[model samples]
Target: MLIQYRRDIADLQQRIRNRRLQTFGLFGTPIALVATVAAGVGSKVVFWLHTEMPNPIVNTFTASAFILIAASVVQFWAEIGGEVWDDSGTSVRDLKLDLALAEERHILEARRHTAPTADRQASYKERLPPEIVRLRMESRHYRRLHLLMQWLLFISSAAISAVTAWYDPPQPAKGVLIGLGFTVTVITAATGYFKPRERAFNLQQTADAIEQHATAIELGIAPYNAPEEARNLELFATTVEGMRADQRMREQQLDQPQQGQQQVI
Candidate 1:
């Protein structure tokens, strides 16, 4: 039964991965973003000159540009209008529920099998508290967003610098330069003010601490070495809750602006 559940979970994971690839395609989003920007520039140039030239200057983008054009068509077609993540007219929700159910079944089976053993380490590992799970999930989410924004900030700043020297005779287009400047400013401000990295770090730290306590409890180590099994579990649970509360307090502190002591220069 455990093996069957494991296989089911793996199959569901593969299905979800395949669905994501079909929905977004590999390297599709970044390619689409670039293609969109290029199309904007090309369309603007064509509109200003009012001339449509036929012939490929370079066929480098031809293979990749199909994804962008197809996206527009897909969006415009009412009969097949599904956004990258809408999951409309699909079994995405059902698949997710099935995956969760399979995972739960596997854990239950494993725990049942290991209950009589002197060391039920695997059971304890699989029984992580909900707060720890949530913390880890949120940590990764914030870290992902934080890194993406930082990269955007860096790229936009670099692009602005490059654009300043791009045009012939070193005279960049005023409007384009202004637009790039705005983009860099927005990215910089967002990353600087929001501080997703700090939030992720705190959450990860709290989760790690909670997991450590849980491990000690499972191993019959100090603090969790109390004679009663229930007492050890209770102590571990209480410690996890305390860490979770501390994590929340840290997040709230991150949201509030820091006040520096007065400095006389």
Candidate 2:
């Protein structure tokens, strides 16, 4: 049952991964196109509604605003895709770290009685140097890019708003202009708040697990050679198996109702 459950969970995870890739593959292009159109529309609107401003100034503001919005849209799409990629990267890293730690623990089990387990630990050395390095490089690179894009979005928005306020002044149409600015600001802030938190939370969970394992080992309660430690590993394995089983059950329940509803319809 545990084996079957693990298989099911693995299958579900693969499906989720594939679905995300497919979504980015299909929807990302359309999103970019839509953003391009949106930027063009914004430019046209500025040209039509705020005609009193000098041609060069208005054109400059329109260009800046549209470029900002279009860049934001592209950045936003990339951010979404980056989030999924980050999660996948973190998952892979966690798996590698866990496997390396587990192997270390396995070696310790075979040498608990020895005065030093260094010789036994030879087989348990880090196998994730390349994987870890690659992930770190990509992670840092993405973060730097994200920060730069964020500053660009902010500067562009502020420049556009400033130009709008100065040129358009407090006319009746000013209300409409301010409203658009406010709405975009609010939406951007709301998404920004949640997306970063979600990524941080996933990374934290893995870090916590690694810390827990280290602490247990340091206390000698989780020595690889001890019967108690082996029992603990068994229990931990069982718990993981149970979680996979529960996930499978949940998926089954979810699919069953959906299938039934579809059949009825």
With candidate 2 superimposed using the best TM-score fit, by how many Å does residue 228's alpha carbon deviate from the native? 2.0
How does model 2 score by TM-score?
0.29
User: Which residue runs does candidate 2 get wrong by more than 4 Å?
Assistant: 1-153, 169-194, 221-227, 236-265
51-128: candidate 1 lDDT, tens digit per residue: 643445324345446666676566435225645444434555677887898898898898887664323443444567
Q: How well does model 2 score by local distance difference test?
A: 0.51
Whole-model lDDT values for every prediction: 0.70, 0.51
Q: Give per-model TM-scores.
A: 0.48, 0.29
Cα lDDT of model 2 by residue, 1-265, tens digit: 3344445556556655655664464456556656666765676677666655457865765666666566556645554665643443233345445445555555565455453444323222232234334434544554554565566557657766776777656475566566657766864764454343333333334334444444454455544336564455544444434543553453344335456636644
Q: Residue 43 deviation, candidate 2, in Å?
A: 27
Q: Count the backbone clashes (under 3 Å) in each candidate.
A: 0, 2
Scored against the true structure, residue 161 in model 2 reaches a CA lDDT of: 71
